[model samples]
Target: MTGMKDVEVVVAHSGRATLRVGDVFLKVDGDPANADIEVQAIGLAPVPTPTVLWREDPVLAIAAVPGRALGALGEPSTASPAAWAAAGAAIRTLHDAPLPPWPGPDLSDIRSKLDRECEWLLANAVLPADVIRLNRDIADAALRPYAPAFIHGDLQIAHVFVEHDEVVGIIDWSGASRGDAMFDVATVTLGHEEHLDDLLVGYGEGADREVIRAWWSLRSLNISRWLIEHGFDPNVRGCEFDVLRARAQER
Candidate 1:
């Protein structure tokens, strides 16, 4: 345990807030179902996860896991290649496990959401039209049919923790569901492209390069608007805006 420390606000938005007090973290969700799913995901995941302390109403308390986050958006990761690989290994284990009973958004739902997001982006002139078009094209590849697997649904790299080149824990599993494996992989490597090979080494088969890249674009496109609405900047260096622009320049 990190021992007693003053309360700190880890994150806060209109919808939810996460606060850290001593060695325990408290997450308060706007939607109670999110907290319920988080509890279920922690219990179900095969890989290391934060230990749940208790749940009451909209709040969930969990003991802080050992180690630090692997990385954060808009920041280059200083974590070792082996640490990335260890996170990949954990992901592979999660995906290879039996599918979760709940299903995530289907291809049609995902496409519809992306289309709506793009339309909003274009209407608001939030991003260059060419860049949006290019990313939309890249995102199409991920819409194809594939056998479903248990996915971390929102496997942001920041959720993974590491110490001494080993993944000690992963947190924030509220989005867990039966879904695409590549999506989980892409989410982790979103802004940190250099670590793709290291992650793929541990994930092994089915790490389709093209599909994974497509998910990167798709994820960036989907989250840009939400991030902005939540008072976060998507244009930060190494973030969603740069991700789309970088891919657009390649074509």
Candidate 2:
């Protein structure tokens, strides 16, 4: 064969699956509108994003960006503190950019989801009722009103890439929307709370610490079941379950 590369499944579930082949990444999304948003968001974001190679109905092809991910969810980051700061700076730039034309989920939607997830966690015995209750209380802080900004709704640590203390790229733009900028920060800093200080160095002022912590709980609650059903484990030592338990200890 002139050229052949082994295909790797980066992630997969019912709604979406991402595959990597050589330097190209193909994402298959159930909803075409999400693909539309990713394309538009990359164009609008001030920070570096994957280069869209092509798109067909349910699949989007993008050129791979350079550098390694900032970190994994359940592990320590090898990326330098300065790299985290650079990511924070990049996020700030994105938040300052003009909002995407598409509308994002509103507060009511989030509130309803929270209520629904809490019920499920209890019904399924996902965790201790007390632990869930404590976290649900902490998660309250994030439900309040905040000025919206362009945000990467799923800015998990692995989504940001860095090399030599500089943020070279951020991937997975399907979740980008108009939302709380702090939510983006908290999402990126989840599991690795120690780097929050360094991240804030570049993020600048007006980022509330309390709200960020609250987001940790809220986000853990929101995604735990989805991760489980998608064949991912959120119960590992430093993952989402730990994030929830850590909050309980603080109370």
Candidate 3:
């Protein structure tokens, strides 16, 4: 019931192809051999606007309906409770999956991204003299923990799928790697609070939510910096930087 021509892929930001396949709908490029041909289709919603690229020969492709993406169910809590619950269960299931051999970019890698931004900001005089160390400290903390797992690098509400009140599939394994599971948790919590609560309900109280929160907050600082230094045109991240500065002052 799906047509290939109708299956238009669009990327809002520029990035390398995570996966590409002509005959199949889902293909992961990192570990090309690890991909599953049996999987019917894969769906992914643009996080920050991916620059969708087409391929004549897909590394991996599957039969699929080019619907609005898996995670576009609605606002976090608006979807059926059962759907949220199923999504949670599926996420836990991913966590339980054996850690893949592939190593993803780590906190140190994140540090590099932050460092590059900081360097640019400093050179441009956007970063105040007093705020450099504070930003450095936050980046250091994020790069401290040596944790790893098969993480969806950009785990967000827009990247999951549900049907019949059950999670039928997961999309956007582009950033998938053996890295910090907490990073994925932070990704969910920092951006989607309501859905995060619902997901926690299913995940139970096994992992310390506070740890995830800390990671989320710290990552937020990092993300804001990245956008301010690189993405935003008029320096919108400057406002976020101000907020973080104020928060730091209060503490």
Candidate 4:
């Protein structure tokens, strides 16, 4: 772990965590109107910033709400349209802001990385061939050039929370990066397109629809390939891959 002298525990994810340090929260800030905030910041607003409450290196941040997150919303339930609408608004707020650097590996260079990962897995006898092939195809498709915009890396309804028929926050900004803004569209349509219309309506302006679509396709392919290359038992980085594959096939 990193030095704890300047950090305190706040929130935790399978891969990362959130912390509160001082006046500046790493992810959560009380400014939705600010264009400088990243799209993922929507969920962070309710929480305090500059404070490392969790003490873990999380990819994203949120307002470590005490007691309950949504109050009446409870856990993620498919019973409310307002819940989804609120999520859409939070996402819209995020999309309106600027993006951080793309830190993960590049799609174009994913082949070599995958090859290494696959070979290692095969050496361990944990590799699958069909899955590997499927991933290769997906990678090829993701490499295509497309417009760049702030993408949540992983945008889905589950990552969002609602308080009262209005979007209160969006969590999990780990995958936050610069890419096709529409990369979240496939997720928006995952279960049903019911909330999608509202999401788009709330997203407002400042997005290149075509570019986002292209990124959406590329992200799906990448996830499929990730699944193929990595064995199941998803509890690792492969979960994102799994979600991408499922979201990709959505009608």
Best by lDDT: 2
What's the residue-level lDDT of 44 in candidate 2? 90
What are the clashing pairs of model 2?
none
Q: Candidate 4: TM-score?
A: 0.49
Model 3 agreement with the true structure over 1-251: per-residue lDDT tens digits: 56554433432233223323342343434444334211211222212222223323335444432323334322333556666666666666666667655566756677777767656656766657456546555445456665565566677665665667666545555566777766776565444445667776665556556456555445645565445544553223324454345435533
- Residue-by-residue lDDT tens digits, candidate 4, 98-145: 555434345557556655654554455443444434444444544555
Off by over 4 Å in 1: 1-4
Instruction: Rate residue 218 of model 2 by lDDT.
Output: 94
Q: Write the per-residue lDDT of candidate 2 for residues 1-251, one digit (tens) a residue.
A: 86879999998889989999999999999899899889989999999999999999799999999999999999999888899899989999998888888777788899899889989999999899999999999999998898889998889999999989999989999898899888999999999999999999999888999999999999999999888888888999899999999998998
lDDT of 3: 0.51
Segments of candidate 2 deviating more than 4 angstroms: none
TM-score of each: 0.97, 0.98, 0.61, 0.49
Off-target runs (Cα >4 Å) in candidate 4 are 1-63, 66-79, 101-107, 110-145, 188-194, 204-221, 224-251
Specify the poorest-scoring 10-residue window by lDDT in model 4: 66-75
lDDT of 2 at 225: 86
Predictions in order: lDDT? 0.92, 0.92, 0.51, 0.46
Clash number by candidate, in order: 0, 0, 18, 26
- All-Cα superposition RMSD per candidate: 2.1, 0.9, 7.2, 8.9
**Model 2 misses residue 160 by how many Å?**
0.4
